[model samples]
Target: MKLETEIKKPSHQSEPDYVTGKKDEIKSYGFECTDCGADINIDFQRQIKYNWTGNTDLISESERTELKKYYGIGLSEKSHDGGYPVFDKIVCKTCGEEYLTYCGVREFSNSAYSIHVQEIQKIK
Candidate 1:
């Protein structure tokens, strides 16, 4: 019988990982029903750290890039207190129930806090 062993090396040098908000803030959001005409709102103060506003606005290049990294969640942008940018929002198609339901914010995550990233760590 024969046994073989292989050594693995790191791909990159050691670097401190950052996993926090670039800048913490709240982005508001509003929802509107397509069928009816009802309106609603949701506050993403803690989740994504953004306020809720019912309007559409252009996102910044850096913000867009950050959002692209995340699958579901974005950054916080605000034009004004009442006219701030919304992170996430959703509306019912079948019913006319418009409600604010979305928090669009993405931040770098640490392996320690992330379940998906810590899967291997759970092993004995």
Candidate 2:
């Protein structure tokens, strides 16, 4: 299937309201294996125990500093909450090849959250 980013839903309106409520736009992300072209769906809530390493070399110094500040700890320290700058390695089921997956969630002021898959690089 093609990548779908946004889904629109009808908003609730109160009684005797003449104006139409704004539709809520939900955004999501999908991932596909780079090597085998297989669709991969990640359940971030379930797969919380995956090994995450601080591969600082993959990112720039400024990014590393930002991540450290966001997580309130050094990149070398373990973080249970999967925030930005994810450095976890995931294995593709179809190709049996390991890939370094970087993903995160962004929350908007309107209470809508979006998932972002920044990079998926195959490990040699």
Candidate 3:
């Protein structure tokens, strides 16, 4: 079972009333490798939050493939509560590993000296 801490927020920001009112927008661009194939072409996207929520198709397919070959994602994040945005997850799909509360977006943005650099570096 997945364990989660009871996250508390400073200010209350009402939940976003999505048009669909459900988990939507699933944009996942990566490889699916098993003990069989080298790397499967797993390039797909949907406007639902089943697998991926805030993720988008920013990087190209070619770039995504290359990224999977090199530095693949260790985790993904989304808005857990109505406080603010945060990178509160790290999941290793290969080993079925997950880590939460590793990063706080608000804290990072507030202290990041090279905010511009971070923006460019963090995103594709």
Candidate 4:
């Protein structure tokens, strides 16, 4: 897969605020395909794992630190328990564009999941 440049946010937004906003709050959060501009919902459970091997090379040092602090867990640390610190490769249902998304799951009754997508890049 060929790696493309990082996705840029709109001029009005400072950071990728959509990355942390709830799906209900942000209508286009994590749904738009960067390549095709298709609105495709991401099914985390059904999507194939990216088999990241816990490599932090794809992400910047500041992003790695921010992710760890926000998630309250180390990105490279392995959990004895299952289901956390998800790093998966997801395909765009419309254009077949692949993306490597890093996410942190909150183990509440509802199990909130947030994707850190400031640097989400397309993979060919």
Candidate 5:
């Protein structure tokens, strides 16, 4: 089978929902082994950096006022949730070569987000 066909779902994952706190989850996929041309399974964990876009509907009016006073913007005073993914290591089952993968998204919003595989490095 092809690399994409071998892995059906993420080996590690998270549940995402705007209402509940359990929103962040890792995305996993597969790739062809660079050395041996065999299928490889990879896993990734999402990361959110310094950006904070808030949900005003969830916060109280007082909180919103305080956030606007501090930041000069009407925000929920929260870090931007739902970021990119970074894979620690993926070992090719066929050739035993290790790799480090870095993946990211273009934007994260209340409506949707985009995901991209940024870089892949061979470690062993």
Candidate 6:
């Protein structure tokens, strides 16, 4: 299937905020389809694994805090190859279309970092 044209790609603000929030964050999400304007709810289970280059010591304190917030685990704890798992696909029940969103560790300037809402891709 083709991407629904109505919904625009989401920015960082749309990411799941749980690490810093007081209330327990729910992994499951509910939102309206950007393409069809239909209500959609998706239950997330860890599906992808990311491996970073260096350990947590490479980043500054502020970056570490941000990383933990987005990734459930702190940078110090991330394994060399096993970063974090995230929801890989959100299937809209109303339209039967799939959208992709995930957070993973990346190597930059010899340091591993977490990126939220990496990309949104339509799937057949």
The residue pairs that clash in candidate 5, if any, are 14-25, 52-80
Q: Residue by residue across 7-115, what tens digits does model 2's lDDT show?
A: 2111222121111132542232346776678876544431222213343334455654554465455544533233333444456788886655444433333433333
* lDDT tens digits, residue span 1-124, model 3: 1333322222224333222223562223223232232332222212231122222243344543343333223344322321122222323345543332211122223322110000101110
Clash count for each candidate, listed in order shown: 22, 0, 8, 0, 2, 3
Give each model a TM-score: 0.23, 0.39, 0.19, 0.42, 0.39, 0.39
Worst 10 residues of 5 by lDDT: 1-10
Off by over 4 Å in 2: 1-28, 44-83, 107-112
1-124, model 1: which lDDT tens digit per residue? 0112111111123221112342532243333434464553343343233322222233344543443343222343422121222322233455633232212222334311100110000000
Note the Cα lDDT for every prediction shown.
Answer: 0.28, 0.41, 0.26, 0.44, 0.40, 0.42
Each candidate: RMSD to true structure?
Answer: 20.1, 13.0, 17.1, 9.0, 15.3, 12.3
lDDT of 5 by residue, 81-123 (tens): 2343322346788788766543333245463544444445565
**Segments in model 3 whose C-alpha atoms lie over 4 Å from true places:** 4-87, 106-124
Residue pairs clashing in model 4 are none
Output the TM-score of candidate 2.
0.39
| Between candidates 1 and 4, the lDDT winner | 4
Inter-residue clash pairs, candidate 6: 1-124, 7-34, 7-35
lDDT of 6 by residue, 87-116 (tens): 245667777767644343333334323333
* Model 6 alpha-carbon miss at residue 35, Å: 2.9
Report residue 109 deviation for candidate 2 (angstroms): 6.2
Candidate 4 local lDDT, residue 27: 29
The TM-score that candidate 3 achieves is 0.19
The TM-score of predicted model 5 comes to 0.39
User: Which sections of candidate 5 miss by over 4 Å?
Assistant: 1-29, 44-87, 110-112
Give the residue spans of candidate 4 off by over 4 A: 8-29, 44-83, 108-119
